[model samples]
Target: MSERITRLEEQVAYLTKTVEDLSDVIARQDRELDQIKRRTQMLMEREAQRDLDEGGSVPLADQKPPHW
Candidate 1:
């Protein structure tokens, strides 16, 4: 009985540590995702600016009518 309890306790401790480790990993991944999102947004904005500089315009079908 005592031996079984000890083993179970050990397992619980290991599981707790594993959960904490996974939580840290998730946090890191979240930070990385945020960084990637920010970088992607910056790149999109830069591309939009480049397009504007080159007189790039949306198609007439895609844009609102001149009356608007």
Candidate 2:
């Protein structure tokens, strides 16, 4: 009975460590995703401003496509 209890304890410890490691990975990925989103938004805004500065009456983003 003592040996079985020890084995169970070891298994629990391993699982606890695994869960902690996964949690850390998730947090890191969340931060990376936020950074990516911010950069993409900045780029889009910059592009729209550039179009306006180039004397376009309508920002390309609001203009209909050539096919239309």
Best by lDDT: 2
In terms of lDDT, model 2 sits at 0.92
Error of 2 at 18 (Å): 0.4
Off by over 4 Å in 2: 57-68
lDDT of 2 by residue, 1-68 (tens): 99999999999999999999999999999999999999999998888888789986676667899999
The lDDT for every candidate, in the order shown, is 0.89, 0.92
Q: Model 2 Cα RMSD, Å?
A: 3.4
Off by over 4 Å in 1: 58-68
Model 1 weakest 10-residue run by lDDT: 57-66
lDDT of 1 at 40: 100
In TM-score terms, which candidate is top? 1
